[model samples]
Target: MIRDIDVVVIGGGQAGLAAGYHLRRRGLDFVVLDAQASPGGAWQQAWDSLNLFSPAAYSSLPGRVMPGQPGETYPDARHVVDYLTDYEQRYDLPVVRPVRVEAVHPDGDRLRVGTDTGIWRARAVISATGTWWRPFLPAVPGRTAFGGAQLHTVGYRRPADLAGQKVVVVGGGNSGAQIAADLVHATDLTWVTQRPTRFLADSVDGRALFDHATARRRALDEGSADTGGVASLGDIVVVPPVREARDAGLLKAQPMFRRLTATGVEWADGTRAEADTIIWCTGFRPALSHLAPLGLRGPRGHIPTAGTQALEEPRLHLLGYGDWTGPASATLIGVGRPARDAATAIVELLSLP
Candidate 1:
């Protein structure tokens, strides 16, 4: 059976929910198709200890503020899950769950969204799948030959899982830092980075990064000199756990290894370290396989988009991927503006002719 709608939102994560709110407010006939079975999208998949860079109040959706936790300064993953579940019910957004969209292609003037269950023919398609599904592992020689267990950050649940084992944590992003801090006391930890990890000023957090992003966007709009946003600040934020770990000299990092050996990894100078496990925090690419039918993606995995709207296919808008999609569009708070703009654009597009 084919259901006709004004818009089809892919991925019911933070970005999709935000877009759904705006679309509902705009009176658009739309439905959100989520691959996941339940609410809280990627937050449910995050590490148990993971918390927002900012406080709950600053890390909220479009309509409701994420109420602060009873004793925690920054809410954990579970709190975020509860908040998203609540927000979905609060707004009464139309969401169809456990629906995995297979492909999206143009069907005459509209888009035909093919999924596991059925087809949704829509005037517009919003791809907000986000990056959680596509965890990236950097290309390295002998990676396949490594004897020890290797897992991405997605597979890591807790430090105790690797307690007393020689584990190497790789990548220089916030995930790398956090996971290393998590494993320091529990495991025999070795932190490796592509480069020396740079921590944002102790005071800087999501709020500060959002400010940079906003300022950078305004500069571009006004045709002024480019002001680098979050990218300019550096790699990781000094969250409480990270700060405490670093102050105790537990979060120190080493340069990345040249290649992986069967037993361990080797540096260019032939320094080798044996490891029982390697946890990669290398980051993720956009989850955009379903868009391959559109034949619009550039060399980079990202579809070239102008403020969430795909340049190649105007009817297709890509949200919550990263800064390329919109300034700070991937963050919980940052996604709201792009979501609103995407919803408004679709409404205008649908209303024409």
Candidate 2:
């Protein structure tokens, strides 16, 4: 059966939830389509030891704040999952789950969202599909021939899987560092990165970094120079666990390997290291495959957007894909504003005569 709505939100993660809040406020006839069987979105797939870099108070979606457990400074993945599930129920948002979106096509004056279960015809579409599904593995030589087990950060669950083996954790991002630290307890681990990983000061956390980014963005918008010495949020925050690992001398990182050998990896300096497994903490690309039918994606595989509205397809808006969609839209705290704006814009567009 074909369902008609004023707006269709694809992907019911933090971004989608934020959008849902605003859409509900406007009393729009919208529905959120989530591919996951349950709630929590990408948080369900994060590593077992993964924790938010910010405190619970600072990490939240629109309307409601995430409640943190007593004595817990940072919330873990499971906590986030539970919070998201609760948030969905609290708002009574119209969400249809486990229905994977197949494609989004322009249908004359409206957009047609094709899913595995049915079709949703809407005047506007919001693509909030974040980057968790599309794990990007760099094109390393001999990668296909590697004999050892190789897994991306998404596939990683626990450290016991690599117990008593030589493991190489690639990428200098927070995931790479955290995974390598966790694996050090159960395996001989090596950290590899394309460039040196910068660690934020111990006093700084995800909240501070987010605030700095917000300030910078505001400064840019106001046409003023930002004099703050703050760096990008991509820099690793010295979370307690990571700090402990570093203090224990288990956080040293090596330059990236030249290529993967059948048995292990080869360094650029003619050095070879044998490994039983390789854990790639390399980042992710946008999960925008369903939008392929639109033919609006640029060379970087992202649809150009002006504050959440798609440049080519104005009826479509994108959220939580990263800064390209909106400043800090990928973060829980940052997704709210853009989502609200997108909701308002959709309402205005649909009301046009």
Candidate 3:
């Protein structure tokens, strides 16, 4: 039998749980469907050394505050995983795991969420599946011909995995910088960036970044001047470990190489660097393959969204992908506002008082 729910949240991560929290408050019948066998979502997959840019308190969801880790300023990935596992239990959110959604299809007024287990017909579907599964690698020439070990952020676990080998780290985002820093002392490292790396001020953390995003969102909503938001501050935030690497002059990034060689990489100026491994800290694209049945994805592979809802399909809300859905919506702290907004909108749509 097809289970019927008022809403079906397509993930059980921070964004999905946040949505569940608000929906419960609104007295809605919903279930968060997760593909993973357990809780913590993508945090369960993060590298061991990864930590949030913000302190624990600043990185929180809707109802509860993430407890501060006494000795640590920024919590590591395992800490995050623990908090998430606890949060799931604390909220008592209805989350069904190991149910991989195969597709979302239109079934009259309700949407049919086809999964490996069975079908769930939901009035509104919130796609909160964050971008961990879909690691992106740029199409540099001869990349396929490279003879060394190559991996993306999703494939990375620990620096010791590549111990004693010459490693090249690609991408200049926080992941790139953080991973590079983690590997610096562990391996022979070459950091490459498409352009000059942009590092935020030493003091800029998650709290400050969220504040900037909120301000920018507010200004845009008011149709006011452009505030630039968090993007204006630069890309990489110098987390503690990253700061240590920078202070030691180990975080320097060379110009992006032109292409991969059989053994390593070649630069535009004819310089070549031989490396045994290339770790692409390149980010992720949204995991929206289940929604493809709806034919809602645009040319850019993103569903056209207006304030979190698919412009073409109002019954669908794409949450926590990025700023396109909501300002800083992909973040733990930034996701609350958009989650609340989506829930509030759903309440109004169902004619709830």
Candidate 4:
């Protein structure tokens, strides 16, 4: 049966849930389709020790707040998963699980969303598919010939996996720092970044970073003349564990290696270090392959969006990909405003008389 809907949100992550919240508030009929059998989006796949840089108060979606457990400052992956599950049940959002969306194509004035289960015709489509599924690995010379075990951040789960092994953690981002911090106690670890890593002050956390970003975004939006330095979310927040690791002389990161050797990595000065495992925390690209049939993606594999609405396809709205789609749209705290705007836009488009 070809089901019809006012809107079809192509994810059940934080962004999708927020969009569903606003859509429900607007009294619009919508369905959120999730690829995962369970909730929590990509958080379900994060490392066991992974915790949000932000406190629970700052890491929440729309409507309800993320309640922190007693004495727990930052919520971990499992906490987030439980919150997401509860959020869905609380709002009663129409989310179909384990339904993989294969493609979205134009069908007259509507979009035909082809899924593994069945086809759905929607007046508007909101693509909230986050970037976790697409892990990026840099192209280093001799990478293919390396005999050591190599894994991306997506494949990493715990430190015990590389216990007693000489491990190399690559990338300068928060994930790289945190993972290296966690693995340093479990293994002999080396950290590699393209440049020197910048660690934020111990007092500064994800909440503070979000505030700074929000202020910067507001200034830009309001056409203000502020040219002061604005801290980005990419700046490593010295979380308790990471700070402890640094205090213990374990958070050192070296410049990127020149190339990978058969046994390990080689530096520009011809220095070679033997390693048993390499963890690449290079990051991820947006999961937009399902929208390829629409031919909306540009050379950079991104859809040109005007405040979350696709410039190429008006009925298609993209959410939670990153700053291009919306300011801080990829984070839990950042996704709500954009999701609300997206839902409002979808409703306005569908309500056209």
Candidate 5:
């Protein structure tokens, strides 16, 4: 027999935790199912040295304040995980751990979710698995045949992991930059990027740099003469690439690789850079395999959610899915409203005759 509930949240990450918090506060009957043994999802897997660019000021989740010194710098990945674990304990959130949900299907005014543990039936489901489910690995011919050590940015922890090895860090995003900078001290590093990203220093009027997104939003609402376009995080936060490398004589910037061979990376312009290891920092994708039949997914695999690109489905919602818009819709600070609203919607759905 399948266990039944009002709602079954399909993840237990930050987004999922936020969702659960609101659900509990609203006195709703729900269960959170997660594959991981604990909360804090991808955060727990982050590199030890990794710290959020956003300071503790704007990083708190709903209700619980992130414990730290005021005007202090951003917290590391471990701090984030610890905070989330504390949130779970404080709320007594009904989260069932180590349960991998395999599939979900609509079933007669309800939904049936299949997991390794058991079957679960719910009137509504919040699929808050997040956008980092699948790692984006570029399709390069002869990639699999390469005999060198290759890793995705998700698995990369620190420079010591690649000490003394000639490493080729792929992609131009924030993660790629940080990894390259960290490894420079311990290895022969080549930062192979598709294109040089336009960078900005992380500060404003000599104040502790806040998210440029916050500034842009205020500019629009105030109707000031200058409603500047979406500003990049590069404008406010100090990116590792700019702070450490490019400034120091540590890393060599190279063009993106056109092809891959057993020996090293081959650039589009017929240039070759030999590397002992290749780290793909190409980013991630949304995992919506279970959402296949929803038919709400856009041109890309992303779903067009209502609150935060939440779906039209009454109780279904998504937080932090990407768009060309300004900053991440799914940031820890931004997720509260959507989670609250989603909980409200779920409660209303349950209360109906």
Candidate 6:
């Protein structure tokens, strides 16, 4: 049987929960479709010791605030997950948990969402599946034939797994730094980097970097896109790579990997770095393989949703997009606004003839 809903949200993370809650307030008939067992996407996948740097005040959804520690610096990963779960139950959002969506395509005036559970028809769709849906690994020689324990940063949860082992982390991003910092005291670790990273400082005293980035995004939006161009787009918070690795005495300031070896990684200047494990912190890809037929992705598989007031798909809107800035371009704190706007847009589409 084809069940019909006014809107079908494909994700159940903070973004999706926020969108779903708002959609209900807008009086639109909607159902949330989530692949996970419950809400909280990245929070569930992040390291055990991880916490949001943006404090509790800015992390709230449309109408709710994080339950505790509103004046605190940030909440840990587990707290975030707990909050999302509460948000769903509080709003009575119709979330179909653990329903894997196989494909979604446009049907005459609505979108046909096919899942293992059943087929759902929605007049509009809010794609809050986040930009970090897929983990991106670099293609390095001998990567497959490596004789060591290799894992993506996503799979890493605690330093206990890496304790007492010589671990070499690939990529100089924030994730890599955090993992290395966590494991340094318990294990022998080395961090690898080929590209220079921009290091944005952690919030000073109680001030958050998120506030700084928000202002920067607004300033960048002032210029005309006709002359400014999307190429000029950059992140609101650019954290330099050098500062993050500064504390890793042996691990700090290492040159980028030239190639991967059976035993370890090799630097560009012919230096060989040996380790027992390799953790790739390369970053993530957008979750849109099911929507490949839409042909909406831009360079390097990124969904280009900036500058445009709304997405090209009248029924579909991309969230957590844009390399530079928007309502919610690339951070957890930035996700709410886009979720609100997208939900409103979706509700409007559903109400129309």
Residue 182 of model 4, lDDT score: 91
Window of ten residues with lowest summed lDDT in model 2? 226-235
Between which residue pairs do clashes occur in model 3? none
**C-alpha displacement of 49 in model 1, angstroms?**
0.7
* Model 6 lDDT per residue over 1-353, tens place: 69988888888887678778778888888888888886777678888877665567667776887766554446778888888888889999898889888888888888898889889988887776765668888898879877898888888888788789888887766677667667777787787666554344432311344454455556667853332322223212222222344544534636677777888888768888778999988888777776666666667775556432235576776665543324344555666666777776665666676
- TM-scores, each model vs. reference: 0.99, 0.97, 0.98, 0.97, 0.87, 0.86
Regions more than 4 Å wrong, model 2: 225-234
State the lDDT at 132 in candidate 4: 95
| Alpha-carbon lDDT, every model | 0.93, 0.90, 0.92, 0.90, 0.74, 0.69
Q: Lowest-lDDT window of 10 residues in candidate 3?
A: 344-353
Total backbone collisions for each predicted model: 0, 0, 0, 0, 6, 9
C-alpha RMSD by candidate, in order: 0.8, 1.5, 1.3, 1.5, 3.6, 3.8
Better of 2 and 3 by TM-score: 3
Angstrom error at residue 21, model 4: 0.7
Of candidate 5, the 10-residue stretch with the lowest lDDT total is 202-211
Model 5 over residues 293-340: C-alpha lDDT tens digits?
Answer: 666667667766555434556656565454222134456776666678
Q: What value of lDDT does candidate 5 attain over all alpha carbons?
A: 0.74
What lDDT is reached at residue 149 by model 2? Answer: 95
Segments in model 1 whose C-alpha atoms lie over 4 Å from true places: none
Full-model lDDT, candidate 4: 0.90
Tens-place lDDT per residue, model 3, 158-180, is: 98899999999999999999999
Model 4: pairs clashing at backbone N, Cα or C within 3 Å: none
> lDDT per residue, candidate 2, 147-263, as tens digits?
989999999999887799999999888888888888888998889999988988888887787677677777877989864525553468788888999998879999999999999
lDDT of 1 by residue, 164-268 (tens): 899999988999999999889998888999988899999998998998998899899899988776777999998888999999998899999999999889999
